[model samples]
Target: MKARWIITAVSAALFFGGSLLTSLRDPWFQNLQRPDWLTFEFLIPFIWIFVWACATISAIIVWERSSKRSRPWYLMGIYAAIALLTSIYSPIVVEFRSLIGGLIVGGLATVLVYILAFLVKPISQKASWLFLPYALWGPIGTYLTWLLIQLNPGVS
Candidate 1:
């Protein structure tokens, strides 16, 4: 029980921290190109919430199935890998700002989340819930990335 709580808390913290760190790096964001509707100030908090929500839900599902030996770690690894990829590519792609590129990244992220859902059978139904929030954020992030690219067409 206590271990479950710890895992949940840690997972939430990782999601929140990763989001916060990314927002803080916005000033260093390389491209000026953005859709008129896509403002960093507004979008950052939204992304943070979406990311946190996804992590929270996923953690809860994991906690509920704590008895499973390999499932929790597998889920954690999947989410972490996806998060890490987002963090790494976000800055670079945003700096370069291209619609097609953003689309590809966004599509990949969505597919990965879906794959994660299928991979974890222990809490497939509940875990499937987490994927929606992740999916929602992927498109928003992709849009922002596309906007950045459009605004900075010359960014190489």
Candidate 2:
């Protein structure tokens, strides 16, 4: 029970931390040309909250279901990796103004999410389902980053 609490707290912290680290109003971000079809900015926060919640639940499911196996740790490692990569993405794009860096990280995230899902399937199908939103969102994020790169040639 205590371990579950700890994991939940840690996951929440990572999600919130990653979210708080992103600032889309900065000058660099403000200067970038948004795609004409990019109308989802308003919904992004809500979508992320949903995705993060699902991810947390999925992690907990894995923790409980795979307690006897080594897969849990490896699975959690991938989660942490995705979190770290995601946390760095905004900083790379906004702080360093590197769209290419964002693209690289976002693409890797997309790939990792799929792998995470694949690995978790044997442990718990329900947990794998919970990751559906995140896995789906990954490509959207990667494509957004790619679009940013195409639209903002001035950014290095």
Top TM-score model:
2
Error (Å) of candidate 2 at residue 110 is: 1.3
Tell me the tens digit of each residue's lDDT in model 1 across 132-154: 77767777676666666566666
Q: Give the TM-score of each candidate.
A: 0.66, 0.91
Maximum-lDDT candidate = 2
Residue ranges of candidate 2 with Cα displaced over 4 Å: 68-71
TM value for model 2: 0.91
lDDT of 2 at 87: 70
Residue range 21-124, candidate 2, lDDT tens digits: 77867887878888999887889878878887888888888888775646467788898887778777777888788889988998997798889988889989
- Cα RMSD for predicted model 1: 4.0
Candidate 2 residue 22 Cα shift, in angstroms, is 4.2
What ranges in model 1 sit over 4 Å off? 16-31, 39-43, 69-72, 87-108
